[model samples]
Target chain A: MRALRLYLVQRVTAAIMAPLVFLHLGLILYAVQGGLSAGEILSRTQGSFFWAFIYGLFVLCASFHVSIGLTNILQEWTSLKRIAAANIAHTFGMGVMILGFRAVYAVVF
Target chain B: MTTTHKVSIWRGGAEGDYAHYDVPARESQTVLDVVTYVQRHLDPTLTYRFACRVGMCGSCAMTVNGVPRWTCRTHVSKVTGGGELKIGPLANMPVIKDLACDMTEFFEKWQKAQSRFIPTKTRKNPMEPIKPDTPARVAANAGIECINCGVCYAACDTVRWNADYLGPAALNRAWTLANDERDGGWADRLKAVSDHGGCHSCRSHQSCEAHCPNQLNPAASIAGLKRLSTSAYLKGELK
Candidate 1:
């Protein structure tokens, strides 16, 4: 892909992830402060399709964000360019997505 | 009481060190004069670059006290104020010799950014009439005076960090060309600048603007390229 497209994707994904990150952090703080148990958290999350969808979108956006950032870092620091570096970044993002989705599924469904 | 100002000049190649010299101070002495004194009287073998002895030619640029500046135009009193002065080759470039850097990469990136003016009409055709009051003409005129001295390129941190990144001078050239209504290469030029190592790599540190001897704002030029490239992408012209 051309760099402009990559640049756009990175920016768009970052925008999507920003609010999601804040929401996730807020949820963690709220659950811990409220002394909510795993069972209580599960009871609140498991039956809600809204929670599943939001978390799913979060996982995708986070994956793209992390991967694009890593790709930029690797390209700047090393001699890697174009396809090889991008492929490595995509593999890393895929790994993040797989793990992230699995964890979200365990919590949501 | 010291009668002479202590000057440290970088000698030799990348692995070398700074050699100290005491230069006799004078009223309104320029950095180039100090370098000339050191070369002619102190060290016969010292190497540097200069031409015109004035600011017209942009050949004699070097690092003076950590800032890239034209040696010809920068006065000793203005920079050092009757104190010690450190002079070296420009930053973010390979030092070829004492106080001289190879500008191959600098010019190469100019080519990469497609900075050349692409004329749409053949020489046989009549000259295209362009009104100077047009916004595009005025914008093109704003940045057309760059003499390619490489000072802005040396001052750019992005170039130092990312080897492939096109520095300020090239981007500024591209911006001027992009604004030229007579230039028939906007599509290709925009594509070139939108590449991985192009205008998007700039972090807007503004070092290029800060160090420009001509007072030209390469940061603004790069910003213009960013806006143009983003719009082109939105319009599907950059796909």
Candidate 2:
């Protein structure tokens, strides 16, 4: 049952990440080629609810995607069993979320 | 002139190592030839399995140089480099003896995956004619030539990772039934294959398609199952 859940989660996260990744890439290209400074970018993005939400969702999807892939890799290559692999995956996802949320808070607030 | 080729054949069960033997190589010689020569001349006790020396029987399959291949048609020139060959039993299976793995689990998973076709009509009733060019029939025909060689099953990584995951051949067989126009239990079969260790478990690695002796594409069949399962899930047909 847990395996099923992980499989479904991976699929759902991949779906979400598809558009988020494109949007993120577009924004980076726009900002870098347009020669926008860090302060200028912050001024436009600072405390914006839309930017916060988009980046937050992006971070969440990325964390889920990376952790699930890493869990499978560990299971295949390392000595970790399913239970230990799940624990490690959850820890990695939580750490990414915490760090991501901190960035969102610093930029938006 | 009789030419000798150095062959290293696996000599025991699961825990065994490769044992080297020099055998006579000939024109159009095959990997099975090497094994047969070693067993017949060098050691009568050496064991392996083969029926038809041709590729039709699908009985003579083993890992030749880290790849699953039909031993009957796989010529020595195609596999051997520097006149050396390393033969072993198929992977992802328990070897019962030298070059022969126990295939009970392999075939049992076919049953578990419900690979058999379920009939919708009795023989006493009128016969139903199925159109050959219909979409379902065409899809079924695309992957129905599998001969149960166990090569794809041995080469699959998903089967190695999740023992319960139905290997490519069984799942491919299920895909054929899923597209059968005469079969009536597609809903049940789809649900059965949509479980944790079912069609969704396939990682789309394409190893089965790569190693299939008949050159059939089981990976595409698996993708078809995923599409069917997703549509079924949306329609509330799958729990």
Candidate 3:
């Protein structure tokens, strides 16, 4: 069933994000060893394929996870039906992915 | 000195109101005893349901001061430190009268989860030998004592939120069957539980575990089903 597939996708995205979140936090601490300078942060991330891929994957997973969570919340809380909730969540996910990847591109490119 | 405590009980249907009475609280008097006193001495029209006076049958479950519990086992002195008792029907179901909830939907969800055991062998065959300590049997043994009391159903937020969700008890029954080695139908059962409104809907609130009088962990059983669903999804076994 589609519900089963989506549930699995939600779980997998959560699993993917767990370690990435820790890594991102660790990066924050490591980067802030000096003052919180945008230039230094961008200098470290700029033109780095590793940083690009890591943040890119993090953004993708977050987009997927948050969308499914929103779908569940909308179904439970709002008057919207299942299909309507999924549609809204999908659009929301697209927005998240677009904004997130744009930020990733700005930092990595 | 005999102390009379205030007892408030819900009367009528979904549009019900709590009726108050003064009941003499006795030493080791169960909540069921309080209800019995109200019915026998105070109000003859007050309605409730119970089977065993002792704790065996779970028919006496009610919301005692907001917590779902088996009234037969819950003593007034243990629960009522404030010297007050508030009793009502089990939640998340249609109240038949006062303390009784219609269990039709509760059992219907059990059927919806495909909880029936599929026999691999008929009566003509000898009994299949299943070892006691095996992992499957151990897992099956963990959740087999459910008495269909519907307490966990009353406590579940997922069941309250998702109309389609097969609540804790049904999925717990499915888990026991899934671990049954002799059952040749777990494949179908697996797919059934993996479908929409099945095991995937549980949010791991553990309210079922917290409220179950039988000490069964439907939450753990649901987690097991989720793991199976994930493995099956990855293997392309479930589509």
Q: Candidates sorted by lDDT, descending order?
A: 3, 1, 2
Off by over 4 Å in 3: none
Share of reference contacts found in each model: 0.56, 0.24, 0.72
Name the TM-score of candidate 1. 0.87
Angstrom error of the Cα, residue B132, model 1: value is: 3.8
Task: Summarize candidate 2's per-residue lDDT along A26-92 as a digit string, tens digits.
Answer: 9888888868787877886798999999989978987888788788867766778867987898799
Candidate 2 structure quality by residue, lDDT tens digits, B104-137: 9998988888889899999998998888999989
lDDT (tens digit, per residue) of candidate 3 on B159-209: 889988999999999999989988888888888899889999999999999
Span of 10 residues, lowest total lDDT, candidate 3 chain B: B52-61
Specify the highest-lDDT model's number.
Answer: 3
Q: What is the DockQ of candidate 1?
A: 0.45
When 2 and 3 are scored with DockQ, the better candidate is 3
lDDT score, candidate 1, position B157: 81
Interface RMSD of 1: 2.0
- Which regions of candidate 2 fall more than 4 Å away from where they truly are? A1-6, A34-36
Task: Report how far residue A38 has shifted in candidate 3, in Å.
Answer: 1.5
lDDT of 3 by residue, A15-98 (tens): 999999899999899988887988999999999999999999989998999899999999987878999998999899999999
lDDT of 1 by residue, A2-77 (tens): 6777777888898888898899899899888868798989998997899898899989988988888788777777
RMSD of each: 2.9, 1.9, 1.4
